[model samples]
Structures are given as structure tokens and as C-alpha cells.
Target: MADHRRPPPDILVIGAGLAGIACALDLSRAGLSVELLESSDGVGGRMRTDRKDGFLLDRGFQVFNTAYPQVKRRVSLRDLCLRPFTPGLLARTSTRLVRIADPIRRPGDAASLMPGRVLSARDLAALAALTTRDVLLPASILKRLPDRSTAAALTRAGISLSAAEELLRPFLSGVFLEDELETSARFFHMVWRSMARGNLCLPAAGIGAVPEQLAAGLPDGTLRLEAPVVTVTDSGVLLQDGSERPASTIVVATDGPTAACLLPGLTVPDGRTVTTYYHAADTSPLAEPTLVVDSSRAVLNTCVLTEVAPSYAPPGTALVSTSVLNDDRPGGEAVVRRRLAELYGTDTSAWTLIGAYIVEDALPAMVPPWPVSRTTRFAPDRYVCGDHRATGSVQGALASGTRAAREVLADLARQ
Candidate 1:
């Protein structure tokens, strides 16, 4: 039997998302008594996965980047059994489908990048220079560059407008979840650099497996699920069931909106909404593990998940994932299905609708002049951390949590 009159824990982490998990893990490893509470039955807030009818559908279309420094620090890549996507894109333009490949990664595919295929000689040279600077130059130097929209940054980099519109806009829009390419130039450069330096892959199990792995590392009795916190006071959090959990310190590590609800006046950025549709196909539309983007901006991006990792689908069936900006329209799935057929140049009529997920606050917007990181300490003992406080990525979430843990440790040491 547990002691009901015991003292409160040293740290109480609200939310079991990546940020909360990372913070709690760090605090516990440092010999602190921590209590991590989650409202949901499982972990991974936006990074969730659904298993239905032998198909694995992620909450939204997501990819794991191997170049994330935080991910490399916390996760074992080998344990995830990651499957890499091709280091290029199959872009659909007004005229034809363009095949773009990284010459450094695929030397034999270099011919596909010749002038007039996807980009002009001048544009290609400019792109090469930009890639070299981003991938080879130090991040400290890139961070020092002027803060501006990604579109303006590309123009300044000497990339032609044609190349920007045809290739960069379509591809990067999928990444930033905005079609205008108006995200922060520093953030864009870092994303591009990561792609250039590492491979984009998927876990053999599902995207949710990433957070599950993080949760598995925590010490027993530290995590409590289905423990919805109604309010957070200076002392601790109050549950909806009229139960109060007292703690010496608290960390709010939830989504942008939820965090704002808990900590009033906490500025939460406007988030990007996305809808992903999963379809079970008899066969994959494309044989290769490449992402297809539409230059017309009809849909954000589409890929055959089974092609990337055969384990994502059952035997003899393919799982296709399509993502589009959420517009709250009727019969949107039907419209997307038609577009998918056109993009793949195959009949999608027979494809079965496996699942559809519409995420309201998928990611925080990273507009120009945005601070790449923010202060995590809210008060003497209260703190807040999430991707919203950083660059709106898994890396940001993990990094922010790590920062919060360091702040807590430092404050405790001072005491």
C-alpha cells in the first residue's frame, strides 16, 4: 500500500509528449523524484499512429530525419529499424514530371539533373552553391545571416524564380506545411541542411514508436496515464476528479494551445493545420520510395509508405499516404483521391479508404524574425517547454525539454 500522507514529488511534469518525456527522463536520471502525468492513454501528442485493418496510419504525414542532433542524442537509430526514403523528389509540374536527385548521393542519377530538365544551368549553379553553404558551412554562420522569408532568401541566393517555384516551393511547402514558403530563412536553411546531410526515413513499426521508445526508458512508477490535469497552481496540479497532486516544481510540456490554457499569458503561436488521408491500394503507384509533390499545389505531398517500409502494410497490400492543407470542405477525401490518380497516372478508384486524420494544431508557424529558441524558465520553480518554444520540430521539442531540465538542475544546485 502507498502512503497517502507522503511529501510531494520533487518534479511534476504535465503531458507525456516528447518534451515532457525528455524532461522527466533527465530529471529522474539526475536522482530527482519525478511524477509524469498524461491525460491520454498513450504518449506522443501530435506524433501519433493508428493501427486499423492491418494498415498503420500516422496522425499526419511525418518523416524522421536522421540529422536531428537531439534525436541522435536520445534515440538509437538501429533500434527503430528505420527505412530511408530516396534522397530526391518526383515533382509534378505543368508540363511533365521532373525527377530530381542529389548528385552527391546518386552519381548515376546525375544526368537527370542536367540543364532544361528541372532547372536552368544558372539556377542549378545557384542551387549547388546554396546547398554547399548550407550543408558544408557551419550552422553558426548560417544563423548569423539576415532573417527573412525563405522565398526572399532563395532569391538572394541567386536561385532563379522558375527553380524556386517548380522545385523548392512544392517540396519545402510540404515540410513547413505552408504553400507560400514564407517560413524563417534560418529554419529553412537548417531543414535543408539536415536533408542534405542525412536520410529521411520511417520506423518499421510506426511513427508513434519513436515516443514510445522514449517512454520505455523512464523509471517505473514515474509515469501516470489517464490522469487529466484540470488546473496548475503554484503548489501543483488539480485533477478533474477533485484530486490534487502536490509538487515542489512543475513543468508544462503540452501543445501550444493546452500549454496556454495551463499557463495564462503564455504566448502560443498560431499553428498549421493538416489533413492526411490513408488509402489501401492493391499495388503501389510508384515502385521507388520517393515523395511526390505537386507544383500546382493541389495537395501537399503523397507517398507509398509500403514502398519505403514494406512492414507498414500487410502482405500483398500497399499503404498510400496523402496530405493536404486543412480547408474544412465537404467530400475533401473524394477530391484528394481524384488528384492522387492524376499525380500517379494510375486509377485510384479501387483504393480503399483506410483512415483520415485532421490535425488542428499540427505544428507552430516559423515566420521570419522568429526566435529559434526561447527561455524555458517561467518562474522560480515553474517552467514550460515544447516545439512551440523552439523551431516547431521533434528536434526543437527534445532540445527545449533538455534545456528545461538543465535549468531545473541548475536552480536545484543553487539551492
Candidate 2:
């Protein structure tokens, strides 16, 4: 019998975001030598945290849908803290504001929600179809589905044209972050499955703490910050400070466009921006911590924050997150604050403006022709990973990292 102990690796992981961290941690656990290099001064790329004048702010306001696997495995519910969304909702329809309390754990919640006052019988039927028949339809070839994406399916199902534009399209765009025609048909099905499980959640402390905690768990010196990687050679990466580091395997886990620049033949299919206006003084502008969405509004689609997470703000202060959709961000911080005042009313004076986190290229293409598919999967030794690599969320980044780590583990197993 052979004494089979696997050989160690000079493993290199590029970018220190969640994906890179995940890969490094897993690889280290497997007894492989792992090094995670980050371009920024610290870890957590898009999910970076900003602390100034007493506020913990994430570079972008991200809401993790319940679909993530890390929620069960990696993300320690004890470390940072978390708050799940309520089953019911509060939606700002054109004519009325509907408050569906207990949306997550309730029945007939949608039926009981208000705002549908403006909806016609056709609109109601279409809304039901979008959630039930269209988005949730099985993507399997064995399961027959309507011809179009949820938006198109609604149209095919005799949903009135006005309803699609005024209601469904706006609501869907906020979630998909793209126009109805551009979104992939399959993505909605995934969302439906997650929604059936639960709504969403926010870190009880701050978004930055989640990524920071993961980094803390890794062996010391595994993660290196401010290591600007100019270009990733087949063997390893060339640093900006005029040093080259080599390893048996490398993972490009930087931002999408940034990754494209680092690796040849990587193109960003489509991009989107997420703009947030932070008011440090506004603690309780809205009566509840529900996600405020106005289907009739175009630019400023949705708003949510750490209202439920009491520790996120000062004793009576609040941090409000407002998102404007576009390939190009409209204006700077001033524009966002103006919109906040317009939507939430003067009562917003309770909170002061602490920071403005504008993620120019927020979400990568989770739809298709899937963006991840086009990236030439740099074979056996070299690799790429990020939110852009998998499903485009914190979980995607983690899963992609775990995937790359497993790849290295397999090679070790063989060695």
C-alpha cells in the first residue's frame, strides 16, 4: 500500500474580495500554501466598508436574496449579526402605498396589499402570472414554459400593455437591474425558488464586517492588501510596485472590467450602476424598515437600509440607501440627496449625510447569453472568480472561491 500524502502548492489567488477570500481559506484548509492578493488597500472589493464620522457604510447597498448557500455554511450568523426581511411588504404604487405586513410568513399577502387600486383586472391577472406561471416556470426542456421572459410572458398572457410598463416592468427592472427585453428568462425562475424559501437579509452590524470576518478566520499573512496586480501572467501576476509573484495556480477575482483588463479576451457584456445617498441624521423617516419601491418611478427605483439593524446607526440616526438605475450614473452625491428629500419628505432632516457609495459597475451579467460563459476559463493552472464569476452576489463570490479552491484541492489529491 502506498503512503499517499498530497504535495503542497504555491497557490496564488488574485483579488481579495469574498471569492478570493473563500478560495484562499479553503485552499489553506486543504494544506495548500495560499496567498490572496488585493488591489485595494484592504479586502472586500465592491463590498468594501467605509467608516467616517461614526457610520459603517458599504461601497454599495446590497440585499442578498435568500438563495445563497453560504447563509447555511460559511456566513457565521454569530460573527457579524443579521436581520431577515419580513414576509409582508410596503410598496409605493402610483396612487397608493400598500402595506403588506408579515409578507415573508403570511398568506394572501399580495392579495391583501393595497396599491393595486390602480391596477385593472388584466393587470392583476398579469401580476399573478408573472410571479406564479412565468418567473417560476421550470427551465427544464421537459417542462414547457411560455415563449418569453417574465415581462414578455406577461404580455403573452394578456397582461395589458399599460400594466407591463407602469407596473411589472418597473418592479422587475429593480430586481433584474435591466430592461425587460434584456433580462434572461431563466434568472427569474431562480429568484422565484429563493423567494419561496424567504425574502432577504442585511448584516446586523455592517456589510463590511461579513467579508472582514471571513478574512480574519484565514491563517495570518494569507491575505495581502494594496498589491495592485497589473497583469496576470500564466504562472502568476505582475505587481504595480515593480515586483512579480509566481504560483502554480492563480485566480483573477477582481472587478469585472478590472478583471477584463488583467486577463486577455475578457469582455464586459453589459454593466449597471448603483448610487446610494446616505443621510446620517435621518433615523426614522419612514414608519417601517421595509423596502420602499415606486413602480412608477424610473431613475430612483428602490430604497432600503439597516433600519432594522439598530447598531448600524447612532442612537437616533439612520442610513438610507437609494438606488438609481442606468448604464451611466446620472449625477453625483448632490443629485442623490435631492432625490431622497423628494421621495422621503423633509422628515429626512433627522439623518445627516455621512457618505455616498456609488458603485459604477455594480452587478455583472447574471443573465445571457451569460457573461461568465464568455470569459475564457483559463484552464488548469490559472483561473478567474468573483461575484461576476458565479451568480453575482456575495454568495456567488464565496462559491466561486470555493470552486477554485476545490480545483486546487483535486490537483493536490492527484499529487
Candidate 3:
């Protein structure tokens, strides 16, 4: 059972998530014998999708930004058949629903973005200035400018506290899975730049399709699912079934916590939690594929998923997805329903609750002074990489994986 008769693989990647898949692909591309092991039944750690009653429920509310350089390099957007959300979002204020469309993209809605109760002239100018700077300047310039909490950066940019609380906070809280806006300003600006340059989209299949595509490109027998690794040593890894598989190199490409578990003394940042609730309705609430946020902060954000991707639901049915920052307290769904009704201006008494997914480690908490990218070289033969080592985004995960492969290749060349 030790498989001692066979030669060891050149590289062993413990995890088949995006990072591991990317790493294994690159390593194999360099003609190295690589083996990727995953404990789960399938890949796509947090990006899995499930089919329930003819509805496709993504493990969490996730979107793909078309502008990420790694994504453009690795993923086939045209093949994914991406469906874009409306260019802007709607915020439900106390008196009325406010629409802030991208005037440059949607000139027709430029009038709708005029100064209003929620966004004053000062707020408008500040927002415009911030957008222009983020969009026009190189990311290196922004990362080097200064680091602070997002709240302070908003104030520094001249965004009014009221405007931030009403619009930016509610919208970004869902994105970062934090309410206090304590995330790093460097991360916020990078996200802002991506948003300005890209369109947020969902694949026609589901978010899981992204990983499935990456895994599909791997060499045969390079990936092994359901192979749980219990221990990792300098020489090889021990499997849960008491089998030992040796390798010349090992990369801990799992999530932050799992990687820490396998590699003792590894330090990982705190993580953020989020829960997404899916509800099925007979009729669609919003005709357009736009996101709706409650200024009251009752729920982070909600959208009609069926509007964006019809394949997510069966014929004649509408699927709505709502997300909360953390594991909602007991009886929170009722409150969310009431808030959704208010935001959509419709009755939800008859809507059917499909599923609620709680992701305890939705993303790594990116506080100030956090390195935008961390070195993946854990040791001469051991390496670690994931979103935790970089910013929390698809771009981060893939870039970390690519970086890990490059390091591994360099080390092997020396050997």
C-alpha cells in the first residue's frame, strides 16, 4: 500500500482548488511529473454549486470580473458564456429608491444619477474624482500611495459620511463580508479599479464552472479526488488510509486554515464569514439583472439570479439570491424577508426558501498594512499559496498559484 515500488512524482500539490489546479497545470506544463490531491469529492473548494429541485445554487454568492489579468490569461470568457449584471446598483433609501448608473456607460441614465437626497453634489464630485483616479492610474501607483482603513480612505477622498453609509458601505460590506469597512484601502482601490474596467458576470452554468474548466485542462492522472492527506513531511505525505506517497516537492495550496494545519507554525490571517440565501418565486421582482442594497443595512445585497442567468432556475420560475455578512442569527431569515419585501416593493409571503449556505471562511480579512502578495516559498521543497497569501479575489488565487509554480520550477532547476 506504500507504493514504494514506483517512482515518486516530481511535485505533489495538496489541494485541487483553483490555486492547486493552476499550480499543477503549470508544473506539468514544464514536463514535471505532478500529482494534485484533494480530500473532497470534487474540486472548487468554496466555488462549488449544487443542484436542488432543478435550481442551481452556488455555494456562495460569487461573481467573475472580466478585467482580472489572470482571468483573461487563464479563463475563456467567451466559452463560459458570461452573463453580465446591470452596470449599476439600486439603493433603497428611506423615502425612495436611488439609481446611480455609470454615466459614461449608460448615458440614458445620466439624469437618474443627479444630485439627490442620498448623493449630494459634493458626494458626486468626490465619487467621480475617486473613480477617475482609480481607473486612470496604474495599480502599482495606488498600492504605493498609502495604506489605511477603507473608512479613512473614503473620508480622505471627500466622500461624505452619509453617502458612504448609505451607498458605498452597504454595497462593499457584501463584497468584503465586513460591515465596519476596516478592510485595507489598498485592496479597496484595486477592487474599485477592476470594477471600473470590468463587468461582473456569472457563467451560464454556475460559478463552479470556472474551476471545472481549469481542472479540465490538467493532464490525465495528474489529479486525484477523495485523496485525503493527513500529514506532510519533508520527504512525502501520509494519507488518511495509512498509505505513504513520496514526492520530490510539496505545495500546500489549500485554504489558509487547512494549509496552516498541514504545515505547523504557518501563520494565516483571520477570515470573514458570509451566508447566502436562495429563494424561489413564481414571478421576478426586478426585470433587470441589477443588485439591490438596503440603506437600512438589514441585508447586505439581494438580486434576482434568474434575471442574470435563466439557466439557474427552471422555466417560469424566478430565483433570488440574498447574502448576509455572517452566519445570520436564528430567526434572521424572517427579518431578511421583510427587508427584501421593502426593497423590492412586493409581497414575499408566498416565496419559497430554497437554501441558505453559510461559508465560515468566505475570505481572508485584509486589514491595513497587509502585503498585497506574499512569498509562497515556505522552504526549499515546501511552498504555500492561496488567496490568504495575496488579496482575496480570483485574481489573487490564480496569481499565487502561478507564482508558486514559478518558484518551484526555479528551485528544482537548482536541484
Candidate 4:
């Protein structure tokens, strides 16, 4: 049932995902008559909640870092009510479990990055120096180079090979979500800036709340749920149910390819899939709420479930989520379980597998020099928005949405 009684908007926003919501939120705040549309029944898109027998689970385990500048500027953390995790991480090496901490804070713990484990002092130093290069000297430093892969530039800067895999690879690759060798150093630096910002926290309620909040503050008739947008012609936009939504501007605020579909021949990257593995456990295997990585395993990274948001799980339960890279893994559950046993010294028989979402084609293939020429590719009156448009992750999506809004506004002002 479509809510077609409302008046058409000055700006029609397609897709109700985080990016779309963020754009709509800002546009409406500016007093623009905006109408947001969603293909799905819910507003959150990939970020909706799943209510089970008693537990409220997220579509995927989503974490927000204090580093995301757009999130901090756009929404208040207190309003959403986030839960913070412990500052340290638990890294499980082959021999034993190790708790890594900032030496200044936890002086009692192991002094090295690996923590509670022995490393060749030389390797440790190399790793530390490599991190300093990636973290401190990010994209802003490489602004001069408009064209070149950042990974190669890092190598040129003398980041050692072993150091790349052991240290830089784990951190940078996880942040960028792809092959280390191919990524641009500029993008790497962008990720580093985020890392330098602050703590990483997940929503106590659910990631969907973030978008829901954005959509909530909108005035009545500003949003249309379950409205499948069919086309974006020269005059205006079209709806799925044979209705035309004519507007001064149409925001193609959708994932990369989805936008391309509406406005044919839009040149965006081919989307890739991601598998999010959620394991509910009686006790968390990893220490603290910090993120863990196994570079050798190609398992992007894992985080402590209970530490970030205690409410994610019911009484005495821990929620573990692992987000894979661009490619899809068929047997993610079994693979995650095997990896868990290898690290935690336990089997999957004990833990309850609550949610395992596999977006066969989740995000677009971002092969660095990202934030590509989306402005040129999209239709004149309709702008695109999503993680893949500019950057990736929560902040990336936020930025994309804001960018779309800004672009649309500029066009309107000129007209």
C-alpha cells in the first residue's frame, strides 16, 4: 500500500539507507521540501533490525568509531545512546592468546603491540614504524599526487614487505576492505585520519537507529516508505507503481549500481558481496572490545561482541561479527567457526549462531583512487549517494549523502 496522498517534493530522494537519510535530513533542515523513498518496507535498508523470539539483532554487527567526522557533526552520540567498549584488543597467535594494549595505559600488560607474546624486537620496530607511516602520514599528506596508488607509494617510502603483511596489511587492508597491493596510499591516509580520531563504539539499540533517527526528525509527508522508484527521465523521476514523481531535482540516493540502473549507462564500479558472520557466545573469546585481525587468514577482522554493546546479546551471551572482503565466501559460518576454534581453543558446538547475513553483492568494488568521478557519471538532475560513491563505511555513506544534497542544492540555486 503506497502513501500517495502527500504532495510532491521540491527534491525527491531515492533510497532510505543511511546515506539517503543523512542527505534528506540536511536538505529538510535547510527548509527544502524533500521526499524520501524506500524500496524496502523499512527505512534502514542494510541497517534494519531483526527481532527474534526475545532478542533484537541487527542485520549485521555495525560499529561506529569516534573517528567518523560526519557522524559527530551530523548526529549527537548521546541522542542515539551508544555503548562504549574497552580500549584494548585480544590478538590470538598460534601459540596462545595475547591482550594488546597501549603501553602507557596498561603498563602491566605486554609492552609490544602483539602484547603478552614474544616478537623479534626488529620485526616489532619495523611494524611500529610502518604503522606510523600509514596512520600519521595519511591522504592529506599525499594531496600533491592526484594519480598513483598509495600502496606503491608506501613501499617506495620504505615500508618493509614483512611489515606490510604483519602490521600494515592487517590494519590498512581491513579499513580499505581489499588487496593491500592495489590500494591507493591517499585512501590509506584517509583511513588513518579516522583511526587517529578516537574510540570505536556500536549502538546499544541497533545500527538501524542511526538512520531511523535521521528519518524521524523529518516533517510529516517528507518521506514515502515502500515506494519503488522505477525511472529518472529528463523531466523528472518515475515511481514503481506507475506513478510519476516530478521534482525540480531527484536524488538517486542509492547504492552505486542501483543508481546506475535507474539512470542507465551510469559509470560506477561493479558491486561486490560481503558476508557478515555473527556468533552468539556464552562468553566472549576475544579480550576487550577492541578489533582483532589475522592477516594470514584473510578474515578482515573480528571484534569483541559484549564489550562494545552489552545489550547486543541477552543475559550471558556474546555476539561476534566478522565482515569479509569484496569477494564472497560460500562456507562463511564453518570457516568462521574453524577460525574461532583455532584462536579461542574452543569449538562452535557451544556458541549459538544467531545471525549470518551474506549480501551476495553488498558493496561496489572500490579499487583505490576511490570517490571516483561520480558527479560526471550520474544524470544532470539526479545525483548519486552511498558508501561506494565517495568513500566506504558509515562515515563514507554519510559523506556521500551530504555530497548529493550539496550538489542538488547547488543546481537548484543556479536554476
Per-residue accuracy of model 4 over 75-103 as CA lDDT, tens digit each: 77888678765554555443455554655
Instruction: Give the C-alpha miss distance for residue 384 in model 2, angstroms.
Output: 1.2
The residue-by-residue lDDT of candidate 2 on 1-415, one tens digit each, is 1112323237878888888888888888877788778878887888776777666677766665555566568877656557765654455556555553443366556556444455666666555565565335453431233233556555666778776665556656667666654555455545555565555777776677778888998887787788788877765667888777777777787778887887778665456676665666544666556776655554445344656566666666666766666424444555556655655665443456676665776776555444322232566676777767665566567877788777667766887
Pairs that collide, model 3? none
Q: Residue 241's C-alpha lDDT in candidate 2? A: 80
Better of 3 and 4 by TM-score: 3
lDDT: the better of candidates 1 and 4: 1
Candidate 2 whole-model C-alpha lDDT, 0 to 1 = 0.64
lDDT of 3 at 113: 72
Candidate 4: which pairs clash?
138-189, 139-189, 150-184, 150-185
| Candidate 1: tens digits of C-alpha lDDT, residues 65-97 | 999899999999999999999989899988889
Model 2, backbone clash pairs (residues 3+ apart or across chains), number? 14
What shift in Å separates residue 39 of candidate 2 from its native position after superposition? Answer: 1.7
Which has the better lDDT: candidate 2, or candidate 4?
4
For model 4, what is the C-alpha lDDT against the true structure? 0.68
Sorted by lDDT (best first), the order is 3, 1, 4, 2
TM-score of each: 0.97, 0.82, 0.97, 0.86
